[model samples]
Target chain A: MIMGNLGFLLYGNLVLIVILYLYLYKIRKIIGFQLGMNISMLVGGFGAIATGVLLIYQFPLKFVIVTMITAVIGMLIGAIFGALFDYQTLLTGYINGLMMGMMAPMVGAAANNSVLFLLFIEVVFLFSLVLVFLSAKNT
Target chain B: MNISQFLFVLFCLNGVIGLLFYVVMYKKRKLFTDRFGMVMAMVGSGILSFNLAMMLFFMFPFNLGTLAIISTMVGGGIGILYGALTRFQSLLAGFSQGSLGAIMGTMFGAVVENPALCGLPAAYFIDVEQHMMLFSLFGTGLVISTFGLLFYSLRV
Candidate 1:
């Protein structure tokens, strides 16, 4: 039962990320470097955290592989988002993503038994996404 | 000689290299603007702290709480040193990034040392030592390449 919920959460996150990516792509031209940096960092860090936590929960045995995968995911997301703006933004996003990715799995591991914490994290991520969307729209 | 000894030597080498980079950057600090200095502090401190924490953890796997604290302090120190080249804002950025990196590195080291801590089975015991060696070497290479890139940025 729990495994099923985890899988659902994981897929849901992926879908949300894809949708966000599409939205960002549509407005990529309008984003300034400062906003671009924030967007990249936000997406990269939260995406990595969600991915790491969910994957670790689902597959507790494959710790190392999960860490590597999440780090790569974070790096890619940050780079893609940051690429829309300046090189410095890209560098900032990349480093931030890498650092967050490196940290995420351990957080997941430490909070393994707490479904409530996971839910809270997901809610926070969604709220941030909404905030970003609103901010982007205003700009 | 042994794996632990090798790790210790590598740790010392990394410290020396980090200090040498600091000296070189100090010599040329006046050439950097605020923004560039901020980026330099953030990147340099983050990478150095992460590498240092990971290696230190590998060398001494016992007493994780103490190690984590030590690594974090070391990272903060490095960040302050790097950020001192610039202004207050960069100092703040460097310190935060350094502390974050240190915490992450320490967690990574703890997990690598004992998979069981993360609820992974102990079946991978044989691979733990190998992973440590591989990661430490990779970290060293990363430090060297990153410092080189930072130096090259000055010319451009």
Candidate 2:
């Protein structure tokens, strides 16, 4: 049952991503990357807030803190991307958010130790930062 | 249900609703009321900030709660300013809807947890109930604002 649910989720996420991509592609001419980034940041930020509240309600304070921090950092990176390449930045944020939002709670559930959780957060944060920076610089 | 299952539902709802709203907004951008967009942005930000603040306060210390509210307000203020300067309805509309969704999600999760809080002491119970009521009221306002921004952009 769990595997089936996961499959369904994976498929749903895939469809959402394709739809988002199509929309972004269609609007490339009408709305530039920067503008899209700005809009996406607002959308992404609120989404992060909702997720944070939900996580905090269910998980331990320490784990939720780490997760929220990671989310905020990711959104910041997305905002920067919006400044550099608006639509792409929003797309990247959207995709990353969908994946991370689905994963963070499970990860938090498994986070029994403080040190491991901190390390996990640090790794995720650094990796996202690097990815966003590289994407921004290269594109 | 467990946290994972709960969050999965929230994630799915967010994705589906966002896609639907974006499609509609994209198709009718030219017809959307520009004047109310800014108002919606401000109201959404305020709702989101208050909801976040209460959540933080309930879960953590005052410091984190203060920081979250301040940052959210600043972010919303900046978005509103940028939207006005650029004459971009998208910025305002996006922020408004995003904040509205965030608050709504938070409210839903709170309601899920509300039954557990019924056995608290009198003072804490009153305090917690007050915050919940405030958050719900704000959520309602945001809902009205979002719908207003969506279909009632034009005056009769």
Candidate 3:
């Protein structure tokens, strides 16, 4: 009927879109002006939802990998690298967000078990966090 | 058990081991065994752990459960907007995210929870069989908090 889980997933994305947009307004003075509206959270939220939906509905399939990788680069590496350089940085969350967006597809190819995939990523997250902390302090 | 059950076990085991690593591994060290350091390490591992759970869902795609993991990750991502907007507020930014993530984590604990919005994925925390969500929540909670602590501990 309502598509149960799909309905809920779509709804959640919508809410995230709103939060991200509101952030755009909140930080428009700071980072948005420089990065443009699209790179900012509001637009990124829409982008992720739109692209994610496409991944779900159209099933172009191939783009799933590209989109997944791009999201990772954008929200994680770019965000963090951007932070280390820029005083105003959203890299940490970006990295984590990318992980959220891509983990499924990345590990989906390998193991059939969700639990194993989660454990693998957690190790990376914690290790990275530690590295970043150590590096930042030493620097 | 099922995939979700496996995930539940994974979270608890990881959390226990992480803490143990803090205690046993750092019993002689100041950083590892220290309250703050231990918290940060635990939280760091927790964030990934939940992400791990989310990844699990992407692989398994267990009906509503998979979507739930998405919600958690997305929610966590969106919350980043908060941290970013506040410019990370204070030393508590990472910790705040962890706390907020836990709150959002509960939504994953609940069904209509929306995988895309809980800040991550439902597969990450879905325990359809044994019905265990505590481990999932704890993992997410530690994640946000760890990020905050890690950020604070940063030299920058």
Candidate 4:
């Protein structure tokens, strides 16, 4: 009975759906960047609200305060991203994600296995360049 | 704290942290105004982290010095997959499913070793549930935010 109240996270689900939409459509196309960003903020901010409550009940005021601060910071970051580049598209986001994903391993390897790591990175980068070349002709 | 409870709470915290991080990273008049280079960065880094996590976890040998290596590996792999797949719509689809997938795998593994996990606090030298729940949540956030921030920073 006690936990059931928080169990009904229907509203949270609803909000997550909305952000998914904006992230996929509105912000992707930059239709109304501010609106989309606001939606994103709602998703994150609401979670913060819920968790802040949980933290206070479960832990202490200090932990709650820290969580609140972190939540605010995350919201601010989303807003900043929206305000700065409201016209970006999801396709582009995807591509950027791809590049970064491919590189980190090399970075990691370099820290441990410099020679082999650099060689692997070079190969991956070379292949990636080719992919970029091919994708460039997509549209 | 309970593992399940910790996971739920941590994810909730991640949601908040992501929002704030996004705001600070991309806050500007021209924010999202142009695709700039972030789109590319996101794709690259996203795939990198996700894949990194998966690869390290699935492929690497189980050892004390290399467990973190797996997490990071899986994270990169996931990132690369994100980059290659559908965006926004695809991301949510993948994220929710992938997260559940991760949880399921972890559950099964633990179940197989239930006796050990539940019993060997001293033998294993770790609080299985509490540790995993906290780490998984934090790791998810860390990987996602890592990609998100890397792309945003690169572009803007």
Candidate 5:
């Protein structure tokens, strides 16, 4: 049962990230540097946290590997998103993502055995994604 | 040197770097506009405090709550120091980011030290010391590179 839920969450997160990427690509030209910085930071930080938590939950034993993977994932996501706008934004996003990624696994591990907390994180992640989309659309 | 000594050296080194950066920024605080100053404060304090907190936690792993508080305070103090050169807005940003980074760093250190605290199996207990050393080294490198970037930004 847990495995099924984890699978669903992981795939869903991937889809959302891809969708976000496409959306950002579509609107990259329209967004300013400030918005770009915020967008990149949001995506990188939350994406890292989600990925770290979900993966850690799936594989409890490979803690070190999971941490490294999540950190890389977060850094990549942030850099990619930030690259759309300005160099400084790229730097900001990269550092923010790195920090969040480094911290995410421990958070996930701390909430061990609590599927509900995972679900809560997922909800919050989705909500933030929606907020980002709305904010981008407004600008 | 052993893990503890290595961590101690790293900790002192991080602090010195932070101080150097602070002094450099202070000397040229007039050159930075509001936005640049805010960014510098936020990034500098956050990263510095994060590395410091992590090393401190690794050094003293017994008192989790106390360490967390100490790291948080240290982070906030660093933030204030950096942000003081700028406006109130920068101060706010630095303080919050610094505290957040410190909290996260302490948590990471705690989890690495005692995987059991996070409900993980203690299979890697023997490797915990190595992990601590590796992470501290990585953090030191991160601080150095970031300060270098900040200094470069000053040049540009």
Candidate 6:
């Protein structure tokens, strides 16, 4: 059952959760937000942890990576909404995570090229980051 | 694209648009958040209704689909009736019980199939070997529908 390079995933998932939480905190501060954003980050963090645990044991490394990335991006988008809307951030993140988790794999598979997939992921990341920065500046 | 992929795409677009709309509208009017729970309930119920209806009519390869639908309908009807007659707490309790019943009934259905009584066309009948697999899928749908109802009811 040696699935090369995935060996780190067994324990790396725990570390990943910690890193994700820190990132959430940093992004929340940058956006000058509180309460709702915190809750959203917590939800997203827990979701990533759950996915990580499941992937480590039952699924492939690729799924683990994709899900973790998608969940983090979802939280960032949620934070942007949290800045604009005071109380709906947690629910927003949940919805985003649900949609992203379900759709990202399909988009990746449909594109059918590693380069294209990476390009798409990077673009989404950049877009979310830009939104976050704009919201932060407005605040 | 497959139905699921199509649905996922639609869901993603909805999420993005909904988020943007909420942000834009919040500046002008905060009405949306006030009814968020109800809105979520409506969406959840609508999706469950569609899924349950689909399962009932299309899942003719095995008898489990019919059983799941029956269980869900019976449970939901009893829940709504009890809710209408009793206190809110009683309504909630009854709804939860009904959802649980739907799940338990679906499990039972998966294990036992009365194909003779199922009334499916011969062409749609599942092979003996695939029965268990399809039953599991039907059972999963039942579980999702049950939880979804429970969530929607609680929101109400």
Model 3's CAPRI class is incorrect
Residues B31-87, model 4: lDDT tens digits: 332333234334334333332333233332375235554454444344334423334
The C-alpha stretches of model 3 lying farther than 4 A from their native spots are A1-47, A60-96, A99-139, B1-5, B17-91, B109-156
Q: Encode model 3's per-residue lDDT on A9-93: one tens digit a residue.
A: 4455446444544544444454432343124322333233333432333222332334344454335433433342242334334
Docking class of 5: acceptable
Per-candidate alpha-carbon RMSD to the true structure: 3.0, 16.0, 15.1, 18.7, 2.5, 14.8
Across residues A23-135, which tens digit of lDDT does each residue of candidate 2 receive?
Answer: 44544455555555544554344334334333433434333234435455435533443433432453344433432442344343444333445444534444533443344
| Model 5: lDDT of residue B75 | 96
lDDT of 2 by residue, B53-116 (tens): 3343334334433545554554455335323422466476545544443443433333323423
Q: What TM-score against the true chain A does chain A of each candidate get?
A: 0.93, 0.37, 0.34, 0.32, 0.95, 0.43
Give the local distance difference test score of model 2. 0.41
lDDT: which is higher, 5 or 6?
A: 5
Q: What would you estimate as the lDDT of candidate 1? A: 0.83
lDDT of each: 0.83, 0.41, 0.40, 0.38, 0.86, 0.41
Candidate 1 — which pairs collide?
none
Proportion of true contacts reproduced by candidate 5: 0.43
Q: In model 3 chain A, where is the ten-residue run with the lowest total lDDT?
A: A37-46
lDDT of 6 by residue, A45-128 (tens): 334333333342333224324443554554454444443434345444443343344234333433333344443444444454
DockQ of candidate 2 against the true complex: 0.02
lDDT per residue (tens digit) for residues A1-139 in model 5: 7656787878889899889889888988999988988999999999999999998888888888888788778878887888888767776877798898887888888887588888888898999899999999999
Show model 4 residue runs off by greater than 4 Å: A12-139, B1-35, B67-156
The residue-by-residue lDDT of candidate 1 on B1-156, one tens digit each, is 699888988999899989998999989988888877888888889988999999999987569999999999999999999999879888999999899889888988887888777766677687998878877886787688668767767777
lDDT of 4 by residue, A1-139 (tens): 4334433442443354344444444334433444443333333333333333333333322321333243444344334334433434333332222222222222232233234433443344345334432332331
Q: Which scores higher on DockQ, 3 or 4?
A: 4
Q: Could you give candidate 5's per-residue lDDT for residues B26-132 as a string of tens digits?
A: 88988888878777887888888888998999888569889988989999999998999979999998999899989988888888887888888878698998888
Q: Show model 2 residue runs off by greater than 4 Å.
A: A1-115, B1-107, B110-112, B115-127, B140-156
Q: Candidate 6 chain A, which ten residues in sequence have the lowest lDDT sum? A: A52-61
By TM-score, how accurate is candidate 3?
A: 0.34
Between candidates 3 and 6, which one is better according to lDDT? 6
**Which residue pairs show backbone clashes in model 6?**
none
Which 10 residues in a row give candidate 1 chain A its minimum summed lDDT?
A: A85-94
